[model samples]
Target chain A: MSAERLLWYTAVMAGVTYLIRVLPLVLFRREIKSPFVKSFLYYIPYAVLGAMTIPAVFSATRSLVSACVGLAVAVIMAWHRKGLLPVAIAACAAVFVTEWLMRML
Target chain B: MNAAERRQAFKTGFFDGLPIGLGYISVSFTFGMMAVEKGMPAWAAILISFTNLTSAGQFAGLDVIAASGSMIEMALVQLVINLRYALMSLSWSQRLGPEFNLIKRMIIAYADTDEVFAVSSARAVGGKRLRFIYMVGLMIMPVIGWTGGTVIGALASAILPDAVRSALGLAIYGMFIAIIVPPARDHRSVAVVVLSAVAASCLFHFAPVLKRLSTGFVIIICGIGASALGAWLFPVPEPDCKPPDLEERSAHEC
Candidate 1:
């Protein structure tokens, strides 16, 4: 992509994200009232993360098996409520080891 | 706040943000490598991190840019993926100190990321209003970590071994799992919502007709659909007591 186009897209993303973050802080000082809206907002992050992780995660590494192993390690560490850094490092280590073993075999 | 007090607040916020900054280094390092691997120039990848300061949204946005998706698609993808910031902003706005004017609010909003929001919210939870200097103090380290790490990652991508580079591709997804899994484990509603999203995403990925849709659309559809369903099926119950106003909340804590 051209530098101009990349910058344009980046600006669009930054603009929308900024609008989302800033508008509420400036204008919506009142507490939100609706239960359903609150619930929906509460779940959006999880849902988005979930959707983004799957299928893509399974292909993130050099091989599907290694990726699957990485995912398993990540899920286990995360289930234990490990910090993001630890979980990420463990997952990467798992994939690295799995792929090494596969190469040796 | 007095000048001395402002300096102290900035120092405290800086230390508080240090750990989050440390964490961002690792995640954004992976982001930098992935962005370059996807054919972005080192500078351009770093530019995205500097400007966006969001993990998922930047990664998703990178995908759209790489795929040459429409501007509309990029905008919609970011709007959906980063919508949580809006909710966090709204929740935290009520806790802002009287001195937080329009300009300060706008500046703080730029750094209203998930980790930053978490730490700031905790500071405000006892009814103490958030301070402008403290918030700025809290954000500076993480911003440096995020941008600096990306610069290193983008530059190092060329020198890193292929095996190492490929393995690191899983890092962002690992971070994503770290974000969602604990919440899902604790809350059945969250678990249901996450699983439903994964299922929907798989359908879009593997289903012949649906697979034709771009990744940006897939994320938007699956995210909105699953979260909306979760809300319908498991609406968060209202607080038992009347939620106290900001002053009342502080008074009760005191």
Candidate 2:
């Protein structure tokens, strides 16, 4: 992409994103009182994060099998309430080792 | 807020945000590499990260840019993929204290990524409202880490071995899991909501018509659908008596 075109792309992307984020924060000044609305808002994080994580994680790595192994390790570590860095490191390590083994085979 | 309290909130938020910063580094690194691979200049990649902190939105935008898609297409894609942040920001609006003015709201809203929102909304900094100073503290490291990673990845994508880069890509997902798992384990409602989202995502990915939808639209549908279902199934009981702390609120609902 040309520099001008890239600049426009980035600018538009940034503007749209910023508008989405800021509009709600600025408009809704009062505490939300509706239970259903509150509950829906409460669940947004889990739903969005879950939707973003799955299937995508499987495709992030070079091999699906290694990705699965990495995911398993990540889930296990997370289940045990491990910190973020440790779980990430363990998952990365798992993928590394699994990929190495597969290559050897 | 008092000066001492403001300092404390900032300190606490900064510390809480450190891990998220680390996670952002790995994730944005992949983004930078992908941008360069698609023929974008290194500076443009960094500029993308600097200007737009969103992960999925940027990725989708990159695809559109590479296709030489129209500006309207790019705007629509970003709007859809990032619509969830609007919901998140709305939720956060209620959490902000009276102290948060328009300027502060706009500034803090800029850094309201998924992880940042998850951490900030879950934990009560001082009282009934989210501390503005604390949020500033939380944003500092992630911004640095994200921009720093993009610069490195864009400049050095060729030199980094595929093995290491691929492995590092897992960090973003790992961070997502880390954010959700604890709350899921603690609250049944959260767990069910997460499962519902996963199911909806799978349906969108595999089903015939739904599979044709863009990723941004699919995520929007899944996120809203699952959350609405969760809300219907498990509505918070009277809002008046609810605890200020979200973690406590979940436990109380249970």
Candidate 3:
């Protein structure tokens, strides 16, 4: 894209994202009383993060097998409640080792 | 409350946010490399990170820009992908102390990412209303780490070895897993929601027409659909006490 077009795209993206984030905080001045709404809100984080994760993880690396191995490592580490950095580094390292082995094969 | 208390809350929030900020660097570094590979200039990619601070939205926006998609398409895509933040913000609306004015609400809402929301809402602030101060502290490092990582990634993409970059790309997914798995393990309802979302996302990925749907729409469908299912299946028991006042709403319900 041209410089001007890129600028516009960035602005629009920023504006839309900001509006999505801020509008609810500004508008929902009253406490939400509904149990169903509360339950839905509670689930949003897990569902959104999980949906974003899978399948996408398989594509993050060059090789599918390596990515699978990396994801397994990540899931295992996270299941054990490892901190984010440790889990991230472990997963990355697993992919690195797996990718190297695959290359040799 | 007082100026001193506010300053302390900000400090504590800054510390709480440090690890998340570090995690963001690795993720945004991957984003920067991808953006440059897609023909965005380093400055443009950095600018996008600086303003947007959203990994999925910026990545999707770049795809739309590369495809020469229409402005409306870009807006719609962002709207769909970032819509979850609206839910998060609504949840947080009750968390902010009465001291949070309109200006502070707008400013802090700008930094309300998944990790920030999780961290800010989960912490027990001793029944106090210093959340706005804490949020300010939480947002500070992420803004820097995200934008800074982009600049480094765009500048260093050519120099970084492919093997290392590819491995680093998984860091963002790792972060997501780190965020979700612990919560899922604790809450059966959360696990069900996650499994449902994964199923929905997989169906969208494989089905012919659904596969053609934009990433944003797919996320919206899966997130809302799964959460709605979770709500139907597992409603929170009604609170025994009356709802707290606005100031006390920041108490530890979430």
Q: TM-score of every model?
A: 0.68, 0.86, 0.81
Write the residue-wise lDDT of candidate 3 on B37-75 in tens digits: 988899999999999998889989989989988889999
- By summed lDDT, the worst window of 10 consecutive residues in model 2 chain B runs over B245-254
Candidate 2 lDDT score at position B105: 97
> Model 2: per-residue lDDT, tens digit, A29-87?
87777788887877787898899787688898899999899899988888887766678
Classify candidate 1 by CAPRI docking class. Answer: medium
lDDT of 2 by residue, B5-53 (tens): 7787888778767767876877788888899999999999899999899
When summed lDDT is taken over every stretch of 10 residues in candidate 3 chain A, the lowest stretch is A38-47
* Top TM-score model: 2
List, in the given order, the native-contact fraction of each candidate: 0.79, 0.76, 0.80
Could you give candidate 1's per-residue lDDT for residues A1-105 as a string of tens digits? 799998999899999999999999899766566887766755666786788789878876789999999999999998887766678778888988999999999
Better of 2 and 3 by DockQ: 2
In terms of lDDT, the best-performing candidate is 2
lDDT on C-alpha atoms for all candidate structures: 0.79, 0.81, 0.79
Pairs of residues at least 3 apart in sequence or in different chains that clash in candidate 3? none
Report backbone clashes per prediction: 0, 0, 0
**Which model, 2 or 3, shows the larger lDDT?**
2
Q: Where does model 2 sit among the CAPRI classes?
A: medium
